[model samples]
Target: MRILVVEDNLTLASGIERLLKQSGYAVDCVHDGLSAEAVVSTEAFDVVILDLNLPELDGLSVLRSIRDRKLDSAVLILTAKDAPADRIRGLDLGADDYLTKPFDVGELEARVRALIRRKSGARSPLVSFGALTFDLNARTLTSEQGIVDVPARELSVLELLFSRSGKVVHKHVIIESLSAFDDDLTPNAVEQYVSRLRRKLIPYDVTINTARGIGYYLSKASA
Candidate 1:
């Protein structure tokens, strides 16, 4: 999964980024709220790890702006504020979960998994599409062919496609999902990732079909 970490504390932010990256997530870190807003406005992320205290915009305003714009990505408030009122306010402002500073990485991972699972309409971390099964918590993919370890972004792409199976997903949509606002990726990068994923999925009977001038569709192979 791709995540945006908006925290001003360099050490803490770097630690969070390192942990998330080690766990196979694509992470983008920004120190201030304006940058956070700019990034969210232009780029896509599966989740945003936002700190309540920030320079420029503040986390509440950032959360408000995100909701105002109707972006559906999950938001997790990671801040030093541990008071009950603060937690309630964050939730009321649209955060999906809250984790105070000095938190465990394992707990953070679990919350992230839960949020993604909920967004995908799955009660658990496991999501199934046709004969394929994806375990978001474990970061594993299984099919009749056997098990495969898919990268976080690739898995995210797969999940998005599977959710809209049989329908063409616009290239921009896919790009937004895999990128952060500050990323300098080219438009063709999405196509390249799709091509790479298609090669990996061939054995599982999953086809990613590209419409000439449109986008891509995911569907089962014909019998």
Candidate 2:
């Protein structure tokens, strides 16, 4: 999954970025609200971790702009304001979830996962195909034999494919989801990750089928 963190505090932003990255998410961050607004307008993110007290634009305005554009990314409001009125205003403005600051990082991660599940219409964290099962919460893929050890990048690619399951995910979309503003991943790199995943999946009767020039999708091996 991809997430955008909009927090002016350099320390907090860096901490959140590192935590999410460790959790197998592609995360991009911006300190000011203007940059946050601009980033949201251009790129697609699975979730936005937005702080209300921001420089230049402020969080509510950023949230409003996001809603105005009708972007589908889940917006999670993270702020120090614990006022009931503040919470109501954010929700009324289309925020999907709210997390008060001085909160547990674990809870924040859980909320993000919940939002992703809600958006994808997935009731369970485990998504399976053939003999392979992907645990979203654990960020691991397991086969009939045992839990498969996958490199982070390849695991990310696998996550994208599983999220879409049967749909043909275009190459550019994979590129976007795998990359942040500073990290650039090429189409060839995507192929390499997919290639590695294919090898691992063969034993489980699962395949990552290429869509010719486009991208890939997950399918069960034919009997």
Candidate 3:
């Protein structure tokens, strides 16, 4: 999963970034609302952890901007306001979920996982493609033969491909999902990851079909 952490407090933002990264998410942190708005507009993020008391634009304005532009990324409001009215306001303005400050880390992680599942229309935690089974909760992949110890990047690419199985996923989407602002991810890098996954999935009757110059799709060979 990809996450954007927008918090003005350097300590809190760094802690959130580390926590999300430890939970196997590609994360980018912005200390101000304007930066967060600009990045969220251009880049694709699965979820945004937005703080209300931002430096430039404030969190409500930022959320409004995201909704106005029709960005589909899930927004979770993280603020110190624990009042009922504050929560209602955030939700009314298009926030998917709300977490009061000084929250539990485990709860935050669970919320993020839930949001990703809901956004992807994933009912169960396990995802199946051909003879391969991916345990979303455990973040593990297995085939009829045995386990597949795919690398982190390859695993992320496979997850995205599996989520949109049978569709041609554009390279740009994968790049954004896999890379953060500081990460050196490029088109060639995405190709390399897909190429590696293509060879790995062949054993499970799965195929990564290239759509010429367009992108790639996941297909199961007819038995």
Candidate 4:
């Protein structure tokens, strides 16, 4: 999944970015609200971690702009503002969730996962397809044999496919979702990851099917 971190605090932003990336998410960081607005307007992110007390423009304005455009990206407000009015205003402005300052990283991660699950309409953290089950919280895929050994990139590719198991996900979408702003993920690299994932999932009766000149989808291996 891809996430955008908008915080004026450099240390906090860097730490959040690092942690999310380590958790297998493609994360982009912007220090100002204007930069955040620009990036959100142009790029697609699964989740946006926003701070209300921002420079240039406030987070509420950015959130308003996002809602105005009817973008479906989930926004989680992370700020030191703990007043009831602040939280209510943020929710009214279309923020999906709120986290106050002095929060635990574990809770932050869990809230992010909850947003993802809600966005995907998944009832649980464990998503099952074919004979395989993927633990979104654990970021692992398993069959009856145990956890399938998958490279991080390949696992990310699988997660994207699983998110839309039967729908065609554009090749460009996969490339964008797997990469941060500074990441140089090419189409060729995406193909390699998909190829590896196909092989690794074969034993679980899972298949990654390609749409000619388009993208890919996940399905059961044909009898």
Q: In terms of lDDT, which candidate is strongest?
A: 2
Please provide TM-scores, in order, for all candidate models, with all chains considered together.
Answer: 0.83, 0.96, 0.92, 0.96
What local distance difference test score does each model get? 0.82, 0.91, 0.88, 0.90
Per-residue accuracy of model 4 over 1-223 as CA lDDT, tens digit each = 8999999999999999999999999999999989988998899999999999999999999999999989999999999999999999999999999999989999999999989878877778888899998888888898888988888888888877776666898999888888898899999999888888888878788898889899998888864
Clashing residue pairs for model 3: none
Better of 1 and 3 by TM-score: 3
lDDT tens digits, residue span 1-223, model 3: 7899999999999999998887678999999989998998888899999999999889999999999999999999999999999999999999999999899998998888878878887888788889998877667889877789899889888887777766888887888888888898899998898888888877788878888888888888664
Q: What does the lDDT come to for candidate 1?
A: 0.82
Q: Model 2, 191: alpha-carbon shift in Å?
A: 0.9
Candidate 4 lDDT score relative to the true structure? 0.90
Please report how far candidate 3 places residue 115 from its true position, in Å.
1.3
Q: In terms of TM-score, which candidate is stronger, 1 or 4?
A: 4
* TM-score of candidate 3 to 2 decimals: 0.92
In candidate 4, which residue pairs get closer than 3 Å at backbone N, Cα or C atoms, i.e. clash? none
Residue lDDT tens for model 1, 85-145: 9999999989999999889889998998788777766676666655788776877789977
| Superior candidate under TM-score, 3 versus 4 | 4
